[model samples]
Target: MSTTTTAVINLDVPGPTISRHVYGHFAEHLGRCIYGGFWVGEDSDIPNEGGIRLDVVEALRALSIPNLRWPGGCFADDYHWRDGVGPREDRPRMVNSHWGDVVEDNSFGTHEFMKLCELLGAEPYVNGNVGSGTVREMSEWVEYLTRGDDSPMASLRREHGQDEPWKVPFFGIGNEAWGCGGNMDAQHYASLARQYGTYVRNHGENQVYKIAAGANVDDYTWTETLMKALSCLGCSRTPNNFFQGLSLHYYTHTGPWEDKGDATSFTREEYYLTMKRAARIEELVRGHAAIMDCYDPERTVGLIVDEWGTWWNVEEGTNPGFLYQQNTLRDALVATVHFDVFHAFADRVAMANIAQTVNVLQAMILTDPDSGALVLTPTYHVFEMNTGHHDAQQLPVHLKGDLPTREVEGSALNLLSASASTKGDTALVSLSNLDAEGPRTVVLDLRGRAVSAFSARLLGASDIQAHNTPEVPDAVAPVLHTGIRTHALGLEVDLPAHSYVTVSLELAP
Candidate 1:
């Protein structure tokens, strides 16, 4: 029997506009993500633009990725901006102690990254080195990237051939300061964040949105400490001038961190567990937001989920430290659910960047090592399908009646997750069915607007473990869904198990 769920979308009463930056991506200096993934060298046979991978850029651009975070997850702490600029050949090589202990040839440095951003039309979100770097070094890097005048750092940028200063809209203070970035306590890191963020000045109209690293999974104390320290009471001074956002890092793993389940070989139990973990982001966001409300009630300080997505065991024969994993139907569902959560709390979550893009954990495009062939993963299709929601006014979705549920670990998990947003005259409603073995029916009770017609697209596979590969790239791709029908209230959608669907409505005036 197919379970049915009802949702009422209030279109006229629109909520906060979902920031397009929420659909952002992360590219770290780990494994093939930067080396063979995005940068194949100007001399290599792969198609590239000034050493930046053109295909990867084109694929990401198609999804309209708003921003790209560069350099490191942990590597940002050890990185020095000077080593990556000047001349590519003369740039110094350093060891990537964070990922596989691999030696990084300074070929893809600051200039190459900014150039890559330009090609993809994505705003640069550079993570500054704060763990091991001095304040002076961090300060100059900002001047080098955003200074338009002939300042010392800006002059050096011109010396490297970039005549104009590049715009950096987003800047991360550090990553995982509680763990990898630096093992600092909450209070200690909060103080350091204010200190480091102080010097990350705005140079020549390039105002950077500084995001300080916040808590891990459920450490509300870290968020509280940062909020209390950064928030000013009864004073004219505000928090945004110093730092505008706080960062949260969370990953959906099937099992314990010591033994993250295989991406394609997960059991039914593990699949549900992964979904349960993915759904917990709502709790984390609410908890952190509550703390922020106590401090900055105006919601000036944005919550940035800078590091997210699934983290499964590395594929066979791959380097363990690389954090490589296959993207399956399960992973795509995870992505959809996360987007729904982001939209529900659009007023709080200003931005979110999926962990690492390309050949890493929950990547969009996976490249073949031998032939350099590119394969678009299932998760990529989800992002491409939901592009309509970017910067759109969020429509409040109220789910009514008994919802479908799956039991896991003595608790019930809602099998249906949904969110809707409107841009112009069109509205996009995204739905996810988390059940692994049965179909589900969703009847959207559209309100405040009349819909003349609608179209739908679906991304799913016969099995939850199905994924894309070089030989069969479209194995889990999206296709136009014909199972939608006009309902008495609005419309009815039949969703397959472990699937994601997006409906586009032609609203009537």
Candidate 2:
């Protein structure tokens, strides 16, 4: 039987403005995300701009990605920036122990990354190597990029090709410090965060927003201690270098991290459990944000979810270190749910990055090696459909209706997720249904605002496991949705099972 649900959108009630940075993407030095997936030799047959895949660059720019985090997850800590600069041939080769343990030729260096940011028109968020490096190394790296002054680093920059300084807005001190980044306790890491963050110089008008490594998953103690310690230290003198934002990393998994189920071969039961875990991010963000509020009531310290998205076993017969997997309809639903949660907490959550954007977990696009083919995944479709939310003011959604639930492990899981936003002359209402069966009838009330006209797009497939492949690139693309109905009271639409829909309304003139 088809289930009926309703939500009241109070357009008259204003809410927090959503930061476009919240929809940012991350590209680590892991797997095909860098080498063949995004970067190839300029002489290759594939179409590219200065060795970067042209298709990949255009595909990401279409989404209007606000920022791109670079260097590493754990890789950023071990990476020596000096080894990656200068002439490509003269650059040293290093073993990528965190990824595949393969030899990195250092072909794509600092110039290549900053160029990528320029191509995509995204702000560069570089993660400094704090775990295994000294403060001098971190400071010099900044000076090399930001200093127009004739410092040693800047002089070397002129020796290389580019003479101008590149602007770096977001700078992360470390990543996952509680585990991979030196495994220090909260107090110890807090001291390092303050000390290391102190030396990161801000040159010219480019003010660096220093983000500190935060909690892993539900480590509230880590959040509490870091906030408390930093708060006490700030009592004496307030410095912009010390932790402008606190980062949190959480990857949704079908099961435990050690045995995260296969990305492409998961059962319906496994999918339900994974959504349950993904939905838990609301609690994680809210809990951590509340702790920050205690220490920073004015919301000076922003909550940044820099590392997030689903992680699962890599494809069979592939390099395990590559972290390559297929993006399915389930991943699209997960992305929708996570975005809604971020929008719901827009007051505190300033920025977020879907981990490993191109070819890693929950990647937006996948590139095939044998055929040099590019395919946009289901998650990609979701992002494209909801691009209207960028830099838009959020409208509080007052959902008060009976929602269908799926029974999983003696629990009733809600099947619907939604968020709304307004920008310029239009409004966007995005909705998703996680139920594997039974379409949902969503009766929406856009109170206080009259809709002159409306259009919609839906991204879904018949099967939950439907995904894209190099051979079949258009497997799960967005289709024009004409299921919307306008009336005196509100608007109504049929949300298909295992689907995501976005309704763009033209406000009454």
Candidate 3:
């Protein structure tokens, strides 16, 4: 016998339109994420478009990625833009001191990065060097990319190949000033953020959204201090000011950052622990948003969850600095939980970016060098399935019955997480069943709204540890879910265990 659960959802009562930027991805200078993972060189046998892997491009394009945060996580703060421009051969070689202790040839630089964004049709969110670079260097870097007229930086850009200025939508002033970006206290980083941001001027038609480096997990003092600093500058919950975004960095892990558990295989206890950690993001955002509310009640500045994703012990023999890990069904559920939280706070949580897009922690696409194989992770399918919710108006969803909890070892975990959105005549419902043992019945009360047609795709696995390997890339993939049924009040769908499912319905026949 199957138990029933009803969720009340009214499309007329909309909350906020989920910003497409919430679905952004990140690419860093760390590991093969930029080199072997994305760029394989023009002379290499790997299939590529202008040195970038064509297969990787096509895969990311499928997600309709809104924006891409690039250059670094820590690498961004120390990175000098000058070292990356000019001829590829003449570009100075340097040590990647931040990641892997490997040598960087400066092969893929500013122009190459911009070209990749052009290919993917994505907006580039460039991070300036604050810890190691000067204010002039930071200002010139922006000028080179966005300045339209004939100036020093603009002239240099033309000499480098880009004749016309490129429109840069988002610009992060620094990375983690609390730690990697700089070892500055809240007041110090706040001072530098304002000074550097002031000179980073708007060029041509490019209205760059300035993002200040924000807090780490549970660092309420940092958010409070930064907001207080900006508030002192007469920047408080208003449009057209010194700060447009404030970023926070957090990763989901069971233990300390050093011992984040395994990637592919794990105990049932670890599984529940992972979800428990995922829930911490809500606490972090709420606490930080509350601080922002105290400072900027108008909610002009966006709470940018710029860096987030699953972090685990590096694969068996992979370089620890590379931060590579396999994506499994558990990660898919983790991602849906994240999107659910972001959607719930869509009004103020303006944007978010997964840690690393290609080969780093919790990546969407995995690329193999030996076989030159390209595989889409289960998390990738979650993003693909939820693409409809992008820019869609978020609707209120009320669960009538309490969520069924399952005891894994000694941990009690709630079973379901969901969010609803509507775009014109179409309504999309995203559901996640975190239970690893049995299926879940989710009865949705559509509030007298009749659906003319309904369809869904589920990203699931029989085993929570199941993942895609190079040889069997299709081991876990999305399939059409057919458990949706209509009854008296509304409809109910049988969500399989360990699955992230998206339902699409057309209300008008």
Candidate whose TM-score is highest: 1
lDDT of 3 by residue, 257-299 (tens): 6688998889987898888778668889999999888778888
Off by over 4 Å in 3: 232-240, 406-412
Error of 3 at 439 (Å): 1.3
Worst 10 residues of 1 by lDDT: 232-241
**What is candidate 2's CA lDDT for residue 354?**
94
Query: What ranges in model 1 sit over 4 Å off?
Result: 232-237
Q: For candidate 1, what is the TM-score?
A: 0.98
- In model 1, how large is the Cα lDDT of residue 99? 91
lDDT of 1 by residue, 368-387 (tens): 88998999999999889999
Model 2 stretches astray by more than 4 angstroms: 232-241
Alpha-carbon deviation at 252 in model 1, angstroms: 0.6
Q: How well does each candidate superpose onto the true structure, as a TM-score?
A: 0.98, 0.97, 0.97
Instruction: List the lowest-lDDT window of 10 residues for candidate 3.
Output: 232-241
What tens digits encode model 2's per-residue C-alpha lDDT throughout 214-324? 999889989888787567433544423478898999998877668789887888889899888888899899999988877777677888999888898898889988999
In order, candidate lDDTs are 0.90, 0.87, 0.87
* Ranking of models by TM-score: 1, 2, 3
Let me know the TM-score candidate 3 reaches against the reference structure.
0.97
RMSD of 1: 1.3
